[model samples]
Target chain A: MTKSRIYLSIALLPLLSVPWFFGPSSSAVVLGFPIWALYSLAITLLFSLLLCWILQRYWSLLAEDESDVE
Target chain B: MSSEALIDGGGLVVMSLYFLSLIGIGLAGRFASREESLSDFYLSGRSMGLTVLFLTLYATQYSGNTLIGFAGRAYREGFLFLMSVTFMMAVIGVYLLYAPKLRRLAERFEFITIGDYVQHRYSNSGLTIVVTILAIVALGNYVLTNLKAIGLIVEAATGGVVSFATGIIALCAIMVLYETLGGLRSVAWTDALQGILLLLGCFAIFAAIEFHYGGLRSLGDQLSAARPDLWLPPSSAQKWGWLSTLLLLGIGIAMYPHAIQRIYAARSTDTLRRSLQIMVFMPLVTTLFMVIIGIVGLSQFPDLDRAGSENITLLILTDLANNIPGIEILILLFICAALAAIMSTVDSALLAISSLFTQDIYRRLRPDSSQQQLTRFGKILSWAIMAAMAYLAIQADATIWRLIVIKLELLCQIAPAIILGVNVRRLNAAAVLSGLLAGTALTLFLMLAGDPIPSKPLGIHAGIWALLLNLAIVFLVDRLRRPAE
Candidate 1:
């Protein structure tokens, strides 16, 4: 579920709104992986999963009950 | 021992190995379910979760065009090309309209095809069948454009060793084989691998470009010093119309039949919803990565023709390798990533078109056909369609934008029937059919009449023009025609 992985995907999201941000500072080394916008993407992805689960499950009159497995 | 021979040998090895891996992924279906269970085979048992769904959606959206075409446009156009980023992002944001509800219905109904949705809403076999086939054909052409781009870019990047027509046939044959085997599940799985490589390739090239030049800031400063106009928005000459873009992609991009089908195949509402959330911000990252490559190329290679803008990224990379110290490996990685983008899209599209034929056309006409029979038909349809596209892509001397415009024009016709169909219960099938036909006809007419929509069309894309008429007809006819349910 995205809820569980929000932290991970957020860690990977990239930023595209800015014109062009790649300077020497763009490749900030952290341990090994560069601390770039990709991290933010991963986190956002995770958050979306959690949010959708909450909204789809609890908020709306959308889903029919899963077919009985019997 | 020579540098040229050494680099050439390395590139060949990487290219050969990647090609073999793609076929193996295609063969992945043999270990999957037997052809007996069409549902399992085609829809991947409707069991994909957030990860596969997200990756598949990403892979399918980016396609070969993202690297070769969009990148090329950004290089030449500059700030106006930034709109390309916004348009793609807007597609994900628009998902909020219906994806949430659609996901729940798909799971509950156990629907594998978008036609099931259309058929249920309209209660009309004729309408559903027609829409389904339209979707298949539109998407077939969509994938074919990307396939054509792939062949062009590969041969261009490799320098004439691989002819464009031969490259298209070879790649398409690989796509058809894997897609015939694994279906949605295989596409999604491979998509995840491809998406990662795609992003890495982008970053690698970004790093390489920045490393060779000073960085983006210096590069931008250099570009600005040379041509300040590139940083500004489109002039009257460029025609980067905003409202038109909203309409163009709103109906055109959202109606990707494969995308809609993937929503149907979601494991749960949660999975579908999550996939869309990340989809919203995709432009900021993926599009940003590409547009920068384009802009950077402007500083690196000024005086490029309009078409040369597209080859800017590859051109820069190849030039960087040849002129700069030692970065041949980066070029190899770039080629791999680019090839992966093309193949990932090709396989997904092959599955989408073949599904349309098998389910919407074949099964609808002959409802009693068994799973084995239907899937056998699906495989045959897959190969046949691929062969046909290979022919069209190679022989057809149409511009890439021409193919994309025809594609969106056709896809725009289906938007009202699907997107609006979910909200309004009283929308009669006959009225919807009327609207769909009118929309398709108007779009085709307008498209045949004039300018490229994304590139320029009275300062608008043809899709926006067609969509306006599409929505207007849907509304007008829904009010005018009183068809009995």
Candidate 2:
């Protein structure tokens, strides 16, 4: 696997771990957002930014093989 | 005219024009394709750019259920339904496991369908056939469930002027017409428009809710006072439930036949990667909005029963149109967007089924058939499948969530063949085939024995249990066979 792919996968681990820290909590609101909602939004934003970075940098390095297209 | 009557008239006209434009795009797709080939028909000649690819992925991933069924679930489950956002993102995350490699292989092999990949990887016709049948059945259920949604939406939006039965038939007719007209090209083009409308509609409704019910602060305060339990942290068991759902939907959705076909349809690796990067964030705008809308519904209409809550989004739309000033246009647009979501899903699933049947089953049986002949067969198959599904949809009474769960239960079984086969070279075809059979059998047995939603014999999802056994069988069989030697 490429370095970026591995980085992306590791970044996704926190998304699943959301249940551990912020699972179904409504008592605490962060900046007017529920704890769980805020956690999710933060992780999603991180994921999107990381993915965009990977695509712009590492993804273009992969060689394209269009030999099979008829 | 009354407000309801005005909505019905305006919504019907907008939706009619929307449907007509879809057919117009289909005709245009037909004219643009220079050759009659399966690749051209099924994958739009593998020529999709970034914008169309991203939107098609968005449209297919977030169906009408995202708008209607998801909100209902959120209204029913409360803050716990925030798991919906996580799971939707997990679908994109799971793609990281295999999509890059699969895309490379697909380009090299010129793969058109998921079955093509299975056939190439396994070289076992039996395994290929079993996986293909599972895909077809899962996708068939998808079409049936969405057809039911279309009927309900039309019936409700038209204020019953269009009966449920008539609604199903008319929408199915239009979907099959355009799908048959230009195949994937047409479907992708229409999906772009639908995806945009869906996003707009979500924002419009969120604005309308704020307009009608003050703001999120007021709604949250009301909900906290009325239903404090909605905010409590999930119990250990419920947390497990959340994880199980994430795995089930994560792996299952990425393996969707239509999704894989889109992966193949991507014009370049960079295009596919960029599209997926954008897709990673859709849950925020789509599923998250639906959950918020549902929560707002809880505060606005606190006494709704379980079934009544599913209509929360639509009911809110109706109320807003009737009561709110200068919001009638937004209501009509939202209705069209909801319809767009449902139709986009139905058309994509229909096209995937037809391609699976044609390229994998029929063409395999008749290897001598020309590409043109196979393409024609696929078009006919699309119409036939839609007709059968429409007929069955009228009689099918399951909730949208239930129907989706049933499909995912079976579809999840194929994950071993797709994901494992792509990543693990030592796993033999026989191991994969046996694992698939055992997993599917177990899932069906458990589903038929009791309540279909919850996992049996354990707190985990039934499909996850089946998948565990499926993975076990694959590993055990692979070790015994020693295929690497």
Candidate 3:
């Protein structure tokens, strides 16, 4: 895997641990949202953006190869 | 408008037209393809571009379960069910582990079924048979469970005007008709529309819920006051449960037979990659919304039992339509989208089952059979399977979500075969075969004699335990055996 892929995978590790660490707490509200929910949504958004970055940076190399071959 | 009036009148009309359009697309698919080969029938001639590929993957992956079962689970489990979002994203992440390489292999080998890949990679017919049988069993359960959901959706959406038994038969008949007409092409084409509708319906419902209920803040306040436990962190046991679910669904769902077939059906590497990149973000839009709906349901309808909770999404839709002004059309659209999700999933599973039977079993049994003959057999098999499933759907007593989990448990065992087979060349056919059998036996044993969710043995999912044992057996056996010269 490329460095970016590895970094993204590492980034995702923390997202998976969000539930374990954040705990469901109603008192910890960020921007009128439960802490857990807000944390999850933030992680999800970050994961998406990071994934898009990985796709653009590394996966496009494969696409370019396909075009070259064609 | 009253719920009954909406369901029986405009709602029914819109759903009927949607069904008709599916059949029309099926006929169009048949006319569009020049060849009658299995590849053309089962894979749309491997000509699916990025858009169709993306939507079909989206539709097939998120079924009726996402809309109904997830919400029900969320309502029942509270904030803990947010793990659903993580598991769904994990499915996409898991795909990155094997899909790119597997698709390349698929293109190189002209692989039609996952069985073809197993047979090609391992050169073990017995292993191929075992893998194929596992896929069929898992997918058959898939069809059975979704068939039940279809009946429930139609019956519920139409305010029970269409009886459950009749709903199953009528909707299943429509699915089989179109599936036979154009196979994967028709399924994918219809899925594109269904996928769009599903997204639209989700957003519409969320918007309506926000408008009427003052968004998640009010709901959160109510939940905190009424159910403080729901706001607490999961216990240690629950954390283990969360990890187990993540691994089970993440790896398992990506290995779904229909999903693998979609990988094979991609037009190009670029198409598959693009679709997957977009797919990685889908849980954000799809499952996350459904989970929110369920969480909101906690405050809105505080006392629903397990079975009743599964109807939370529908119940909320109905309430909104009845009480809110001018949202009847949105309610109807959401109902149609729910049906679309269920039907899309059923058709994809049906096609996968047919292709697996015809390509893997029947063709192996009669190697002399032509592609045309195999295609015919596949069509006939679809009808037969749907008939059997519809019958079982009516008689079966398990909940939709439980049935889905059972399928995933069995399907996850096949993962080592495909995932390890692609990544590890040294893993022999014997190892994979033994691993598969052992994992399957352990999964069944645990499910039957152990916990209802099959995660009671040490709080981890039984499927994950089975997979661990499977890998252990594979590696141990491989170490003992010498490489072939």
Q: Give the residue spans of candidate 1 off by over 4 A.
A: A1-70, B1-7, B235-240, B450-458, B482-485
C-alpha lDDT values of all predictions: 0.69, 0.83, 0.83
Per-residue accuracy of model 3 over A1-70 as CA lDDT, tens digit each: 6544554583466346556675444447665455765676677677667666666566544222232456
| lDDT (Cα, tens digit) per residue for candidate 2, span B178-198 | 888888999999999999999
Model 3 chain B — which ten-residue stretch has the worst lDDT? B1-10
Which window of ten consecutive residues has the lowest lDDT sum in model 1 chain A?
Answer: A10-19
Q: TM-scores for chain A, candidates in order?
A: 0.35, 0.59, 0.58
**Can you tell me which runs of candidate 2 are displaced by over 4 Å?**
A1-16, A21-26, A57-70, B1-6, B451-454, B483-485
Error (Å) of candidate 2 at residue B392 is 0.3
Candidate 3 stretches greater than 4 Å from native:
A1-15, A22-27, A60-70, B1-6, B450-455, B483-485
> Candidates' DockQ values?
0.07, 0.30, 0.32
The most accurate candidate by TM-score is: 3
Kindly list the per-residue Cα lDDT of model 1 for residues B320-398, writing each as its tens digit. Answer: 8787777878777777778788778778777878887788888878899998899888888888988998998888776
lDDT of 2 at B427: 69
Q: What tens-digit string does per-residue lDDT give for candidate 3 at B266-316?
A: 999888888988998888788888988888888889889887898898788
